[model samples]
Target: MRGSVRKILLVFSFVLILLGFWFSTTNAYTFIKGYMLFQTDQTHIVNSAEEPSKQHKDNLKQKKLYTIRPNKGENIGNLLIPKLNATLPIFHGTDEEELENGVGHFDKSVLPGEKDNSVLSGHRDTVFRKLGEVGKGDTLIVETSAGSFTYKIRHVRIVDKDDRTVIVPKPRATLTLSTCYPFDFIGASPERYILVADLISQKLT
Candidate 1:
């Protein structure tokens, strides 16, 4: 009888140990599966959050790539000076021929309304005869194939004829108009009259 009782007790203890091992194994697998699922959800959330920003950058790149750039000497647009009640044709190049026709866009600079500086030059005797009348707080409107951009004159500068600051890059869209200083001078002027304007509004075509 004593031997039989001892065997039974040993067998019962073995069964309990096996049950504990199975429970522990099942718990570990459940924990690992839950952790993997949580990580997958987090990865999906991150991708979703980044998609729109990536798409916006791609769209901007496409627009920049496909933009139409005018050829040198092309008729690109017109400039309207409300203060002077005048409208002037704008050509792509600043050569003598372009200046004779109307406002001449410096070929080295960006187009009007684009970010950075857009330089327009004309003879003091002709196209810009009355530019001196337009001063700060005045408006200059540029109508182009891309849009109509309105700029408000922020500064009027009289710099040396050879000054290169008139064509320097700007932090935002800017319009720089240049003409010989001393609008009434008899011969070639020694200085340049400059109107620096900041873009105030735009109407895309």
Candidate 2:
């Protein structure tokens, strides 16, 4: 009788262990799926939200954002590239290490409507990978809380590391997209890819 009871207890304990592991794995999978979905949906919402009330924050960024240079950090509003289905934190100063994950506001990169050239940089692998799919005429929107500014793609090019022309301050409202080049290269990319666009419109939302 004693031996039989011990065997029964051992079997029940073993079953409970298996059940616990199963539940843990199930919950983990569910949580990961939910998180990924949130990021994907948010990227779309910020990129495409035309509802004025939702984007009221951006309209305030223009005057509030500062002009900090390299090694200096500033929050330069938010960047939304619809073609890439990406919305990323925008920062001032294009420090390469800082740009490893989020969009780096090129220090002298033009504002939406200010000078001739404005540029924003983000990592191609995470927040801006969708940029690779962008084509001519695709819409790029930048939100400042109070409104949105839009741009239309004009051209795309891959330039050598020394091509400094693309970074020059421009005279028209232009958007320049920047990323490490030779995208397919398995090693350190030695080039840069730039997408140039012209401002088509701006509005309060």
Candidate 3:
């Protein structure tokens, strides 16, 4: 009787181990595919209200934060890269799951064109794969339903994981782009690649 009980316990443990392994592998693979899908279909501009904040920036004057939300009857402002002549979707409220589709608005960052800096992030392998292809003078366009805002790539830098300061919101019209570094390395990336952009102009749609 004791032997039979021990055998049953061993079988259950084995089954649990197998199931755990399967779940982990499957989800990781799904997320990787989601990384590719992240090029488009991941914006929720429903956060259409601005708030007051007191954060300091390395540049620009202080101002209130702008609010954002998905377009109601309006369309999502498109994201275009002049160098690749490539374009994709942009949306508000970028979350972990939403990142599986395309560009995600950094919920912590300021909204576009109101006051402080508006930062956006996406998977480098998917939406931002071409981002590495952008040169210093290359152009990034965010055409909202209201107007089109242009930004020129100013500088790109790689930093350690502890450096979250690079993404702080400033009082200027700027765009911040970030992704994991050493793009080809497998099994978790430890570095960050960041792009700093200066707002060039805003054209009404």
Candidate 4:
């Protein structure tokens, strides 16, 4: 009876050990599976966040580069004013000679159709003699080697001739036209007649 009891005790101990081993193995498998699933989900989230950024960079790289750079005093384009039914030549520099020939483009500003302020200036007595008749809601079109850009007038102002705000940077594509104020002023005018326009459309050439 003592031997039988001892044998039963030994069998019970072995069964307990087997149960413990099985439980531990099962828990280890569950933990490993959970960890792998967590890692996969993290990887997926990271990839989702990075994909748009990568695509944005690729799109920026694929955009067309504006390569129309004209020398100072060179004819670069034409400015068409629909209200006045006029088309004027646009030159690169705002010098006296260029202004005498046609409208003068401020070299410091961006070119027409670009993503910044493009400024054009003309004499009150010549190319822009009737510019006073043009007000807000008028359309201005610029045709350059790069493309033809249409802009709609948004604001009209008469600022002092020395005001630097006329050439300030714009948030988007803009066109600024300036001429001596009082269109009938005998000589050098004291103020500038300004027309600010926003780009409406563009046709690539």
Q: Residue 14's C-alpha lDDT in candidate 2?
A: 97
**lDDT measured at residue 166 in model 1 versus the true structure, 0 to 100:** 92
Identify the runs in model 1 with alpha carbons over 4 angstroms from their true place. 1-12, 55-66
Tens digits of per-residue lDDT, candidate 3, 114-187, equal 45677777777888776677767777888766577889988888888679777776767888777777777675
Screening candidate 1 with a backbone cut-off below 3 angstroms (N, C-alpha, C), the clashing residue pairs are: none
Query: What pairs collide in candidate 3?
Result: 38-101, 38-102, 43-91, 44-92, 45-69, 45-70, 46-69, 46-70, 47-68, 47-69
Judged by lDDT against the true structure, how good is candidate 1? 0.92
- Distance from true position, residue 93, model 2, in Å? 1.0
Ranking of predictions according to lDDT: 4, 1, 2, 3
Quantify all predictions' global Cα lDDT against the true fold.
0.92, 0.75, 0.71, 0.94
Clashes of 1: 0
In candidate 2, what residue range of length 10 has the lowest lDDT sum? 62-71
The 10-residue segment of model 4 with minimum total lDDT is 59-68
lDDT of 4 by residue, 60-177 (tens): 7623526658899999989999998999999999999999999999999999988889999999889999999999999999998888999999999999999999999999899999
What is the per-residue lDDT of model 2 for residues 70-175, given as tens digits with 9 covering 90 to 100?
A: 3456565677777667677777677876586478877766555454788887766666666778868788887764457788888998888678987887667788
Best by lDDT: 4
Comparison by lDDT, 2 against 4, better one: 4
Is candidate 3 or 4 superior in lDDT? 4
CA deviation > 4 Å runs, candidate 3: 1-76
TM per candidate comes to 0.89, 0.60, 0.61, 0.84
Each model's RMSD to truth, in Å?
Answer: 2.5, 24.7, 28.1, 2.9
lDDT at 83 for candidate 1? Answer: 91
